[model samples]
Target: MRNKSIKKLNNKMNSKKVIVTFLILVCTIFNIGAQNITPDSKVLYKKVNGDSLYLHLFKPEISKKPTAAIVFFFGGGWVGGNPKQFYQQSKYFASRGILAISAEYRVKNTHGTSPFECVEDGKSAIRWVRENAKELNIDPNKIVASGGSAGGHVALTTALIKGLENVDENLSVSSVPNAVVAYNPVSDTTLKGYGSKKVVGRETEISPTDQVKKDMPPMLIFHGTKDKTVPFENAERFTRLMKEAGNDCELVAVDNMGHGFFNGDFFRKGTGNKYFNLTAYKTDVFLEKLCYLKEKPTLAENIKQVSCIGDSNTEATYPKFLQEKLGENYQVKNFGKGGATLIEGTNHPYFKKKEYKNSLKFTPDIVLIMFGTNDANVKWCLDKTRKTKFIGTPQEEFKSQYIKLINTYKRKNENAEIYVLTPLPIYEHAKSRDPEIKKRIKHLYDWVIPIIREIAEEQNVKLIDVNKLMKKAYKYTVDGIHLNQKGYKILAKKIAKEIK
Candidate 1:
């Protein structure tokens, strides 16, 4: 009886071992799959004082070519911050078919450096990605610069500020990003803003607000209205200035929230996750607008190409904001030049320029024509010496040139849809800068605009009244002549609505 019991116990032990081994195999397979979905790789992007700054990359299981990328910087007031702060974001973007990276920069805690060094390292990280784009399967033009708080300032400076690049790095490789996503960024580092004292006399050089220009990339900023650290007014002011410079900037305001409200991992629990998720969702929407995501939030498919042609207002104007409003499916190109006119004998004729040829080459599905603003110039239009050279009056010549240009496009592509846009209204304040321009403005309002409308009717093409829209948002105009970023956005919305 004793021998039988001992054999039975050994059998039970053997059964338990088999079950344990099977469970271990299942868990191992699960873990492996998870790792394959989001795998981490590290590479040294910069080194300073014997310390190696590494970029922690998170790559997704891509089925096809992965062309989009996002590089994130962590925020800690430029004093101390860890790359882990953006680990969750990196993984999230990687899963969405983006090559996500969490970059390490010289911080006060580790490198004993200030904000200037941090900015330098940020630029280096972008250059590294752009330089190695082909090898990493990333689109150099589609790379996005994103960060939170002080790190947000670095990202903005990388795209805006001209100098302060790393001396040891490759200067040929540009560090500027195509777009920016900032969270509660210290964008205005002026005397009234945070980090001003830290940057010292270089405040204006480092401040993204102070560095605003006409051609900076589209930016999306998230800020809390109640936040005291960075203050909500800073974001408002920065975006205002950006628009004033004719650049696209979108601000998402979180009501009654404070600083550091966007960290998803920190707010993983409870209602805090709601705020984090909201920001992420909005970010996805913004990226989708830029055509960075493969699957958009909306159901539109089969992208359409759009070409915008005209003067300075058309150069970096509403097409950019239009691109954002139309989402990824509609590709918008700007073929505008400053001081370009429809009349051939003018100083800068639109038809004679290379942009016209390029626009024809694009063979776009939709064409937006916004001329007449510069054509109405007194020196170019009503000049006594040049006026008689044309077949008729300046207004009559404008109509004829516009009709010929329209016919040229229609003949080239019968299927192409052309939309004529009325020139934006010029404010008196802008006209005051040049007396001749002010006189020209009267001619535009009285003669040029009516003829444009008449031509649209005669050609049987769609007409967009941009002047009416700009009149409503006249406050967004910086110099009375050109629409600021906000005005462009408003105009773009009107154009986009017509297109849809």
Candidate 2:
């Protein structure tokens, strides 16, 4: 009896320990994911037949007038994919002062709806947004619809096809959007093009391009030359037809790129963009065109467009000073965000946010790059957690991606000249992160400086060792992290001297 009692007590103790350990793990996970919760978004629904259709509407943050809205549809080949895939893009648009609505329609698997029914529902969503524009603080006249793949098909079809009398009468409004931005879309549904397979009788109705006519709103089409699913020529043909109809149209061909080019290169890196062959692709130049479509400058226009491309230092350090030095020419177009490596820029976040814009409006005649800092940091994790593939060891991958970035810029802009600046030295001041961080910085310089020399020798591109030059102007820097106005003046002058 005594031995049995002791065994039960020990078992109880182990159970308690297990519970405590599980609690600790749960707390740790919660801590890692503890971001500020965004306010609950407003959800609105419309009853269709006996069921209900839902739309997630994110109103503009600050606007005097009803903002231009987008009834966004997510891509799933008409059978699958979820509406939640648009969370980031929707929030981004809403944060940028645009009203965004991510709409949900019956999917083929879920509702057994035909492709035609999906298109009809897409049209109905646009009509709903327009009908309730005033109530939703949206501009009916300026509503724009956008999507990718099948979603792109929906956006383009709605904009290109004029009269959809079958659209829900209860909504009671025109389905036409003022603008359509289709990302790697099925421009010709007839499936008779370079990349399309015959799907006329099998899946979808006849090609929407066949139904094209005049009065379609301005269309912006983006496609990858290497896209096997959707032909690049389809985009070209659609743009041609729209132009022939006297409607405004523009197509941005992403060189060495492929299908679903939207987030593949722009949203996140290593998100299956390896097939894109983006080693020399200029994606941002195209995106900026969409943003500044009405305000695009002519080729002869000499606008002071400066690009500050680098890692964290570019974002946290040089931009504000560069802005002051150039006065008006400084647009603070820094391509680097935090923890971003060179590969990320060439393939993703930077390409989407910065480079896509440059493709459309103005290629930077002058680019200032200061990136080796992160590349050299040995403690840095080369592989992103979500992206299991190793981007590469610091030396091999960093050097290759940087070379690719320069080559890409050259390919995009014939007159483009990149001024590669070595990263600044780590400051002597630090509490805990000083010694190891500084050591890594030195390691980066060892790898990067020699590579820069080799690059200068091989290519016509210019290299500036800001580390050595800044030593002469050390007093101009703030915390040795960034440049003050005096430092920027000196840095710009040094760059100008190098260029001259």
Off by over 4 Å in 2: 1-40, 47-53, 61-68, 80-98, 108-114, 139-142, 160-172, 193-206, 214-218, 224-226, 243-257, 262-266, 269-455, 472-500
Candidate 2 per-residue C-alpha lDDT over 1-500 given as tens digits, one digit per residue, 9 for 90 to 100: 12343343323322311122323222221111122223124344455656577776554444556667766777777776566545434544554456777778777788776566667777887887787665565678877777777787888877866554353465356887878877777777664552134244543343556767888877777788888877788888888888888988888777766666455222333232221212112222233344522222212112234566776666664555454444322233455565556644333334445543443233455677777666555545343442323355556666676777787778766677677887765554433243466676567566777776677667777878887877755565455455566666667666556654
TM-scores of the models, in the given order? 0.52, 0.54
lDDT of 1 by residue, 1-500 (tens): 12343344323323322122323222221111122223266766777789888888876444346468899999999999888767756766765667888899998887899888888899999998898775566889999999999989988988998887988878998999999999999888887789888888878878887889999999999999988999799899999999999999999998767887777423222111234445666777788789988664321223455889999998966887887787644557778888899986777888889889888765567899999888887777877576334677788889988998898889756878999999988767734565777787898889888998999999998898888756776687777788778778888988999998
| Clash pairs for candidate 1 | 243-485
Candidate 2, after superposition: displacement of residue 40 in Å?
Answer: 7.6
Task: List RMSD in Å for every model shown.
Answer: 23.2, 15.9
